[model samples]
Target: MARKTSLKDIANKVGVSTSLVSYVLNNKDKENRVGKETADKIRKAAKELNYFPNLNARSLKTNISHTIGLIVADISNPFFSSLARTIEDEAYARNYTVIFGSSDENNDKFIKVLDFLSTRQVDGFIVASPEESRETVLGLKESNVPLVLIDRYFSDIVVNTVMVDNFKASFEATNHLLNKGHKRIGAIVYESTLLHYQDRCNGYLEAMKQAGIVDGTQFLAKVNHQSLQTEIQEAVQKLIFEDKVTAIYFSTNTIATEGLKQIKNVGKKIQEEIDVVAFDENLIFQFLDVHVPFVSQPIKKMGQEAVRILIDQIENKDQGIINVLLKATLETKEKLQKVN
Candidate 1:
């Protein structure tokens, strides 16, 4: 094993021309019409010899690599990790390979990943978490690159997106607390720039306004993505001690988990002293001593949908954007209480 297996090696074993083997392996011969028997033989030989086509060579010939690039922000996040698994599975099923890249919320890294994927000549792209703008996405669109947006989407750039309806989900979560006799409801939000985060804030604002709770000075707190736990804990203390917030709604998992830890750290009774509801569901539910409601997003569906959209675009070269706003479900363990 000095070198990897090649199409020529498989062709030699099958007693066929390299071009014939290439066509059969790549599935590029429509007029040549490869026979099932010949195709099967070629495939069997390739499999036995562990012959994998050189993607570069195949790409040069067909201008397609049967591969896709997936870019996500913060793959460490459980939500993104779960989505990545689902997308990889879907890509495997379609005989397409996937390469993953993480931006880590850095604009320069995001641009670099886009450039890398483009230079590699990936057949399509599944973009997960774009920072703020869609200049990169728009550039891909103009170049006729098959792109599928996932997790978060931008209205300005017309690309197929698969994500949960953040506004409605957050609204429902807020309304749940409102119906549960919680008047002074506080919120712990992640950073700005992300559309999902903004939608979540908008939902909270709408719910609070509808309840005629106008004074929002101490009711809202926004925490940066990094060092979220400390910032959220400080904000929660402010809401509880200074502003006297009775109950709190968390916008996402990272914030909710940290806020929960802070509440317990302060020796406050969760159910009795402060009630809580969260948007992102996690294993934290099992550890909680009291009933807590969580909004569950179909993360696996989002991943599968991203793959579907990308493959469809690659096959059909579709121009119109397909926006899929998946619905969210509320999982509640406590009885609903009526608020005055």
Candidate 2:
């Protein structure tokens, strides 16, 4: 392996003492202990040499790992990927590095990831999808491992979290479909015990009831991740052909995309025979012939808040748990008329 650039090398290149170079690079010269010209020369040489700080060495000196563990549902999904990117950028600005892992919404894997990160001495963690990992999260709290949940949270856990109000978001999105003159609406969601999904499910039910559609069970379908394709096809066929549904509300972007594909395979035109309103936003929705309505949360804001909360806990800046609830924005391109 190629040798890495060291601070000593920068000091030697600039004809300065190693301690002086360290003071300037670490920005510890606020007292003007080192001359400005000398500092500038050290910085220039460091940049020229592509100098990078050794995190391990710094951890030993400062007792701060300066690394954060980020565990999310699925990084491949646009919503999670975009949110993770925002969190990473925010953490970088605070002199922290981000290490990522995908839990695939599996509780066992999520716990394993947390343990592994703990072993590596990460300062804290920003986690999402805590439905089945209730005990594990509670354990983290008991252990005083600084952690913040993003995207999903458990009321039973008493932990810091940053997320949009899933219930209100889903209710508004479902109401959007209802306002477009579609009475027979179907909803597709992930089959989970998580509060996030349950909140969305309740929101859809509330809207359907408000619209005088009492038969809620017939219009909703839930599927696990392992059997997404088959279940999506089955749900779409049943909802469209058997139930004569006019529109569908997808609780997430993942479910929406799968539902769209199933609709196409069943030879249906979007907004013509059926309209859709998804809970999360994705760029792929723009390319569709049908103007798929979508709800977008403050993804960047949530990410930044997660980092700030986790860092605060890690530094003992906050003594109490913080729960941040944000709002969602609905984006619409076209409205669907009632099917004759």
Candidate 3:
């Protein structure tokens, strides 16, 4: 293999000292009082020599790996996949790299990934923590590790977090269904201890209460992550047949997809037999016979804020804790005709 080009090679070609080349390549020329013309020549020579800095050596000297670890619940899920892409773009724009993993909503796997990323010497972490990972989050905080929780977080933990106002999002979705004459509406959600899920459930309950429904909990169904499809089908059956609900609210996109499938299996059509609203938008909803309305979270903004806050924590140890709750909008094709 050909030898790797080095800064020394660029320096020799430019007839400059290695330190001057380092200053220009590292973007420290202005601070070091190097002339702009000389800096430009150094940059030109470095490009011509195809010189790539040794990141490992630089990291060892500066104590910054310039890499972040991102852990989400499920990478295949469209919401998370989109969020990850946005984060990657934002991080790249800021000259940082992201290494991401999926926890599969398992606390043990979440901890393992955390440990693995920590060993890789990541500068910071952005995580959508799994249920029952309170101690793990606390441990990271206590260790002074730079972390920013995204999409999900523990309410009791005092740490940096960037997430949507799930409660409001759910409440608006539930209220939208109610406005369309869906009094006996039901909701399907994961049976997780994560505060984001709880907030969503609470939002639905509160909206039902405000609509004069005495006990909305009776219409609520919780499904486990381990048996998602099966549980969602069962929940949809019970809500439609037993509870006699005229509409359903799905808390997550995965739940919405499975519930819609179950609805089709039972020979029910959206907005015809039953109205429906989902928390996160999905492209599939648009192609259906009748488009489904959904709560649209600002995914790009959430990812950008998470990276910004985590990088801030990594670079500024004295920065105060930050908690950001972004708003979500209810998106629909058109106002639905009132149910008879």
Candidate 4:
């Protein structure tokens, strides 16, 4: 490997005093009266030597790491992964490095990652507050950690939060099916014990009742992550076979994907026979055998905005809590006329 170069070597090569070089490199020369030509030469020489500033040591003097931590419920989900990449890119543009951690939807792992990142001297944080970690939300306020919650919100906690309007989004999706003449619409949701999951289910019920469907079973179906397909297949099968559900609405991308698979397995002809709509976005929906209506959440925009909020809170030390509700867009590839 080539020898590592230092500021002293660059100063000697550029024929300038080390103090002058330091002043120029640190941008302190504007007040020190150092000539710009000498500063330019020092910069050129440092570049040729591939000299990198010691940010770690410099951060110690300023008491700011210029870094942020991003924690999510699950990194495997494309929505979260896309959000992470967007946030990382935005943070990079702001000269901030972002570290990521996944909570795995477990309180233990959530607390562990929160504790681990807290020790890193991160300037701020962007967190997806999982439902099981409500107390953690309360504790964050006391820790003086600048925070922005993404994809979910706590009604009781005062904090900066950015997320799609889960209730409105799900409600609109169900309303779309109802407008398409779907009466016996079933909904599939995935959540262990989170309130946001409950919100989606509630939205489905509200929409069903507003459409005059009083029966309860058609409005609710809960599934775990691993048994997504099995649960969807069983629930949808019952809706088709026993409950006489002519349509279904999924509350997430994962559930939507499974719902499509179950519908296809039962028979592709069923697509023309029944109506379907889902809360989240997925590529599968884009190419489904028949055009099914679905709701699109702006995942990338949410990620970018969350980082901006976190940075603002960190720099301004403003404790004002904000709840930004982004609207969801609805898409339908096939125009199925209202049948109800």
Candidate 5:
């Protein structure tokens, strides 16, 4: 086997700039920047010479590491894991590599990770949690770094973002339980710096208010992220035994799973004594003898669009503060068997 032909080969054969050849081949010539005749000539030369993008060589020439830095709140959480997987695949498809890390929702830890990845000269960043790193993000923006925020973002700063409508999704999910005649519902969520969680908590509050439930905000249980495992179980117990909530809404999968464990420990059956609703669904949840209605986000689409925007920012310097809000669906389990 022979070494594959490179972009430079095609550029040399077509008498065009290597930059022009790259833009055309990467489909980044969105504004028809390259004339049709010139694009055709480049393509013809590439095909004739069997030229392929030498990503490594191009990285050296363009001063791009061909790598992206992905910082999530916590990779152990299923949502972040799934999001990272999708982003990694999408970045690789665009001829880029991804270096991922978990921030554990700590601003200091997040800053360290960003510093490490930045030193590697990664071309861009796709951040899932920027709630605590607002200043750091602003610095990166000022430095002309390409960035795309997912999951959560800062409202004060203008940044490219891809997020689900958390307020609307949480409102609909809570209303789903309320519509089922569960007037007094409890919500278990970690109290964090993420703006999305605040929106979710408010959504639940709004639903309770709409149902004419008095002191509706009282049912919202916000726990510390560091002490969530203990705090969540205590909160669940309080809602069930003391407050006598007829239903519970978990704002994230971490809360949902822990809430379920608490419910089971207290010997309660879902949809019998109380109903349950959560933000994200997992395969293991399906096997549980419980009816769990969940809000499903378009994770893959979010990842693809974020990567596309970041690449655009890198190639064309087009960082015009794009805010893409995607819709989430409320999936209800209509059929659930009762456990004896």
Candidate 6:
């Protein structure tokens, strides 16, 4: 293989000292009082020589790897996949790289990924924590590792977090169904201890209460995340046949997809036999013959804010903790038509 180009080669081509080239290439020319013309010359020569700085060496010197670790519940889920894409774009714009991992809602897997990323010397983390991860999150905080929780966070943990107001979103969606004469509406949510899921469940219950509908538990169904396919189908059966709900509210896109599939299997059509509202938007929802209104979270904003807060914490360790709860909007093409 041909020899790798080095800073020395660029310096020699530009007729400058290696140190001067280093300062210019590392964007320290202003502080070092290097002339702009000379800095330009060094940059031009470095480009001509195809010089690429050794990130490992620079990291060793500055103690910054310029890498971020991102942990999500499931990368295959559309919400997380979209969030990850937005995070990648935002991090790239800020000159940082991201390493991604999926926890699959398993705390053990989450810890393993965290350890692997820590060993790789990532500068910080943006995580959508799974259930029973309070201790793991607290440990990271105690260790002074820069972290920002997204999508979900502990209510008592004091840390940087950026997430949507899930309770408000769910409340509005449930109320929308209620406004359409859906008194016996049901909700399907994950049976997890994560605060976000709990907030969503509470939102649905509160909306039902406000509508003068007592006994919300009769219409609410919780499914195990590990067995979503089977459990979601069972929940749909219970809600539709047993509870005799005319409408259903799904807490997440994944749940909504599976629930919709189960609805189809039972020969029910959306807005015809039953009205449906879901927490997050899915591409498939738009293509269905009927409209499925959903709560739209500001995904791009969430990702950008998470990266911003995490990077800020990484750079300024003394900065105060930040907790941001963004608002989600309910998107509907038209008013819900009550099923007879």
Off by over 4 Å in 2: 1-62, 335-340
Candidate 4 per-residue lDDT over residues 102-209, each given as its tens digit: 997776577667656755767777988765787666666545678888887777777888978777778888888888887878888885566667777888888888
Superposed on all Cα atoms, model 4 deviates from the true structure by an RMSD in Å of 14.4
Residue 255's lDDT within candidate 1 is 84
For each candidate, what TM-score against the reference?
A: 0.78, 0.79, 0.81, 0.77, 0.78, 0.80
Ranking by lDDT: 6, 3, 2, 5, 1, 4
Show model 5 residue runs off by greater than 4 Å. 1-62, 335-340
Q: In candidate 6, which residue pairs get closer than 3 Å at backbone N, Cα or C atoms, i.e. clash? A: none
Instruction: Mark the regions of model 4 whose C-alpha exceeds 4 Å error after superposition.
Output: 1-62, 268-270
Against the true structure, whose TM-score is highest?
A: 3
- Candidate 6 has its poorest 10 consecutive residues by lDDT at 52-61
Q: Write candidate 1's Cα lDDT for 48-95 as tens digits.
A: 785533433323546667889999987887777888898899999999
Decide which is better by lDDT, 1 or 5: 5
Candidate 2, residue 339: lDDT: 48
229 Cα displacement, candidate 2 (Å): 0.3
Whole-model lDDT, model 4? 0.76
Give the per-residue lDDT digits (tens) of candidate 2, residues 38-130.
888887787578565443343344467789999998888898999999999999999999999999878767766765665567887898864
TM-score, cand. 4 vs. native: 0.77
The predicted structure with the larger TM-score, 4 or 5, is: 5
lDDT of candidate 6 vs native? 0.87
Instruction: Kindly report which residue stretches of model 6 are placed more than 4 angstroms away from their true locations once superposed.
Output: 1-62, 336-340
Alpha-carbon local distance difference test for all models: 0.80, 0.82, 0.87, 0.76, 0.81, 0.87
Q: Write the per-residue lDDT of candidate 5 for residues 1-340, one digit (tens) a residue.
A: 3556677888889998889988787666656578888988987886577454333333344576678989998888878888999999998899999998888877667766776676566788898764467766665555567888888888887889999999999999998887776777899876777788888988888888888985787888889877878998899899999999988999988788888888888899877787899999876597887668899999998999999998888777745778899999998858534323
